[model samples]
Target: MTKDEFIQELEVLIRARYGVILINTLEEERALDLLTDLARKLNKRLLTWSCTRGLVMDGNTAVHPDTVDLMTAIAKAEQLAEEPSLFVWLDLQSHLNSSPVYIRRFKELAQEIRERMPSNSIIVGPLMEIPTELQKEVTIIDMPYPDLNELKMIISQFAQQYRDRNDLQIDCSESALDALGRASIGLSKTEIENCLAKSLVQHKRITGEDIDFILEEKKQNIRKSGILEYVDTEKLETADIGGLDNLKKWLEIRKKAYTPEAEQFGIGWPKGVLLVGVPGCGKSLSAKCVAASWKMPLLRLDLGRVFGMYVGSSEANIRLALSMSEAVSPSILWIDEIEKALSGLASSNQSDGGTTSRVFGTILTWMQEKKSPVFVFATANNIGSLPPELLRKGRFDEIFFVDLPNEQERAEIFRIHIKRIGRNPENFDIAKMVKLSGEASLGDGVRLTGSEIEACVNQALLEAFFVRNSEGHPEGDVTSADIERAIVQSVPLSRVRKEDIGYMRTWATDNAVRASLAPESALSSAPESPAMAEVTVGRNIDF
Candidate 1:
């Protein structure tokens, strides 16, 4: 429950349990006034405790005493009381652990007072951990962050107040109000008010941009909580990616769901997509590119960071991080190489004595119950390492298997890299380059990732300039020869993980995962066994 709801419930509980009441909050003076008003309604003597003066404010005026012993003071006040009422206030809990005698005496006095008269004692502090013996008698409640409606009210109040002073002429449009309201979702009342005031001062008028700026500022506070890191991507786009047409199409369809128009049409926000595939086939790149395309903030979750050394701290950290992600709605949460992080959880009992298992449980619960618009995009290279619970449908919208780029995709990869390095494709013989590259041994061709191809082109360009200036080479343009030389020199991830890639391809074909590439086309292009007759398909299409 939110802070207001918690307070309202407390008020009702206080009234129903006993006619007398007491409240304690961070704002001590405000708490005193609220309790005093409740005391007036019951027509009972109200008592407060001051650490230095001892037993002050007995309904009418402040009372001073020479002794500061709270238990003794409470006893003396009860003895001198004119009306049959209870004492309620704060500031005695800190010294409870220091003095065992005082704690025992206070508990006995509290029990006796409650039994004899219609009296109740309520103690409040910043962080309260009640002793096990008194746990039954005390109620602990957590004050939650402000919700949308409360935030809207706060924005409205600020706009109205600002408009009244200095003829500010503030126009509180519904869109602007909504933006501000959402921006303040996870902030405290004081924090929201402060941010609103600062935003007004910075922009001169609160616009959507100002609202975004305020939300970015609030994101810093979320980061300070130490659960989630605010990630800033370096302009990675779908165009920079070479293949994964199915994955791209899937993402394009969901892009509209983030807009206000989709909400008007009653379309639910997209949850996220899971990319599971062979290593270096653009799974991680796709995660970053999706966030870039959606124009939302991206947060990278390093699972290792969530596992703490202290017991129970790891679980708490995970909850806090998930809470922050929810607070910053309409954002992308990227968990790269998830298999490595969660692999230990499969046999956590044998591994770390159940710490990993507990952490896994916490994440599973959050993934299922989370209501926030934070799209969770997790990429896994090793499917065998992933727990079966994560593959379930409700956890992610879809699971896409990114296999090795096909012949068509390989040509696209070449063109993308050539253009990226400011080389005119028409000037170079792309067809020969594609033919030479595709004809290479399966191990050589499959070794190339989108990133590796880009690196090859870059190296080729540097060689081209060197040959033209120093060697006075006859070849004016960067040819297939240059690219071939670079490819041979470079070692790709596929070469290093050949066995793993073969396993992934077999798994994709047999398993339930949807291929990110065209199924029929991929099957046709795949190499045939030596036993099969040599077959040739249609005319050659090159880059």
Candidate 2:
């Protein structure tokens, strides 16, 4: 549920359970204001709980009381015959875990107050962990990140303030407002307000560029979580990826669902996509490229980072990471090499004494129940190693098996790599290169990625420049020969893990994973079952 809904529900529950209520939040300074408002609404006496400057404010102004100590404050509160009084304990929960005497006294005071006057004690802290003894009496409410409406209201307030000061007129269009709202998602009110103040001061005017700045700030927040890495991909688009046409189409269709227009039309956004197949076949590349293609921010969730040393810290970290991702909706969450990260969970107790299992459970629960538009792009190299719970239908929208690139895809890959290095594909014979790297020989040589190919081209260009200077001849452009030599020298993952690749191909085809390639293309390149050539009298078979 949203933050507002959660708060409203808490308010209702508090009213139902106890005649008097205390509402406090983790927001340090804002907690006082919130509690004051609650006190006014409930017509209750406001009492503060603090050790340093105990009971500083009575209602509005500071009225230092005689009883400032914790025991003294509790005694004063209990002695009062007020029908309803809210005792707001701020930043006191942190001390409860370590101080047993304080916890016992607080519980006894709560029990006694509930019987006499309609009084309730609320504990507020950055992190909440209720002991088993007080869990029955306490009601925990999650204060979620701010929503778009709240963010928009805050931005408009800032804009109006700016216009008032400088006599600057700014008319925010729907698209501009949307950009700002989306950029501010996953940020607290204070954070967004701070960003707006900083942006206005820096740019002298809030424009679309400010929206990008806000997104960068949000990325920094995600990075601080330590579980998710905020990656800035350098213009890597779907076109940059040569293979995975089916997967590309799937992502393209869902990209539109993130727009305001789609929301108006009541179109539900796609949850996620699972890429499972052999390694080095653009699975991970597709994950990164999809984020770029959608024009959304990319957050790489390293599952390994979620496991913490503390008992419950791992689960808490997972929740925080997922919460942050949801706050930044319409974003791509790439979990690269997922199988390896989760493999330990299969024998969790034997491996890490059930910590891995608990972490895995937390992740699985989030994936299933999450309502955010954070598109999960999970890539698994070994499907067998992945837990069966992850392979279930509802976990991801569709499971796609990305096989080795076909001849057409291979040619596109070559072109993409060549152009990436500032060399036109027209400068080289791409068709001949494809033929030379066909099925049998290509398995080893042509398995080079766009990145590896670019590196080879760079090396070849250096070699060509040196040769021209030494021989006193014109510098020649890098030819297919250079790429061929690089291919021969470099070993591809396909060559090293041939058996593994073959096994994956057979598994994908047998299990009916939606093939990322065309049917004819898949049939032609049967890496699992190679076709044997028959000899004829007049005809010859070529390898």
Candidate 3:
């Protein structure tokens, strides 16, 4: 929520005489500033306290320093029968729940303050720790991070501060300021200040380039959260991924879904797609491509990390992660290997005390009701582990089954990997490798995944890299012979998990959209494709 909206709400609550308000926030200094302003507007005295400061007046002038103890502060607050007033306890939650006596005293003080003259007490801290006894008396308010307008205000102020400086310049345009505001959504005021200063120092001017520095700052937030990973999408391109033509086409159609023109055309933001099928078949890579292709930040949600040990902690962590994603709208949330996170869903009630069920339910509900531009790209290899509710209609906009690459896709994959490593795809005879392998009869090469093909290419390159010619110099180019040997040495997942792959194909045939549109000629001639053979998997693809 914006600072103004928060102040309006606080005004309403204070007017209605809410006994105590607990604000959960990381921005303690910003929250205190808002409270002080609110106090002045409402004609109330503002008193601030800390374990060390001991109940100071507005946190500057001390009042009875002997009352440094929390219990004494609570007692003094209860006795304060002055005009309408607000007492803010800064970081009190750090030690508020450690002792039963402190919790009881807090409850008593809250009840007493409610009966006294117009006065309110607020506990401001990052952690939310309200004892059951005081849950009824204390109201919790989650202080949202700075919104776009506030961020813009911060930027304007920052630029204004350097208006007199002769060495530095502010080269920000109006549009650039808007973009910076959008990029700085999830950052705190202090973080924005520090980042703006860093940007000026690094480039000697604040311009569009600072957005990259701001993104780097956000990476620190992701690292600190430990649940969501900041995926670097700068190097990823839709062209880097081979095949999944259907999926690529779908993504391209909606590439402008978040644009203003689309909004004017009355198109709602695209929800997202769920990719489920054989492992190493480009499901996860597509997630990265979606973000890079559409120009959005990529956040990888590790559900396993969201499950916390404390009671109610798991739910809170998921809430925080979702909120963080929403804050950075027009972004992509990539949940890789989602099925593994929900592995215990079948017996969640008996196992983990229903924590898994709760977390899954939270995600399901969010996916259905969320209006944010945060598109979710979830990939799963173990389809059976996924609950029916997740597969039901409307949960995800579409579910695409990423089957193994066909012969044509395998060739494309080989070309992409080979080209990426500075080698021309035409340098090697990919077709000869396909025909000579001789194991091309099983399901028309339905087993060749893009990853395995890349592996084959890599193996061939390694052979060429180390092998010495008769002249003793390193071989300059990879050959069909080298590729054939690599393909022979490797075994694709299709043959090893043949039964599982067949089951998946059967399920996907009726239940999901196909990600590939393999050419009939390639499928017919190769039959099972070179991937069926043990001899030529080609270049290695690393995620």
TM-score of each: 0.75, 0.88, 0.92
Model 2, 378: alpha-carbon shift in Å? 0.4
* Per-residue lDDT over 1-543 for candidate 1, one digit per residue giving the tens place of the 0 to 100 score: 655676676666555443222233344544455456666766766776657667665645556565366766767666644344446556766766667776666666556554565455556444344555555555554444556887777678777877765534466788877877876666666666677677777766654456666666766776786766776655678897776776787788888887889989998877777788766667887877888888777888888889888766777677667766776677888888888989888678897778888888887777777767888999998988989898888888877777666556667888888888787777666655554444254344244666677777888988988888888776676776898788778776766787786676566654535444544544466542221111111111111
Candidate 2 on 1-543: residue-level lDDT in tens?
665685677567656644223343446555555566766787777777676656544545333555556666666667652557667776576566777876777777777766666766766566566776776667666566667776777677767666655644354666766778878887777777777777766766765567767877887788788898988875788888886666676677788888889999999878898888766668878877878778788899998888888888887888778877887877888999999888887688997889888888888888888877888889988877988888888888877777666566767888888887788888887766655445456544235544455566677667777777888878466788877666566666665777776677666654535434444544555431242110000111111
Ordering by TM-score: 3, 2, 1
Instruction: State the local distance difference test value for candidate 3.
Output: 0.79
Q: Which one is best on TM-score?
A: 3
Q: Which stretches of candidate 1 lie over 4 Å from their true place?
A: 1-142, 164-169, 200-203, 256-271, 418-445, 461-482, 519-543
Stretches > 4 Å off in candidate 2: 18-26, 29-32, 58-72, 80-83, 167-178, 207-209, 264-266, 442-455, 465-476, 512-515, 519-543
CA RMSD of each candidate after superposition: 6.5, 5.5, 4.5
The TM-score between candidate 1 and the true structure equals 0.75
Scored by lDDT, model 2 comes in at 0.69
Best by lDDT: 3
Error of 3 at 163 (Å): 1.1
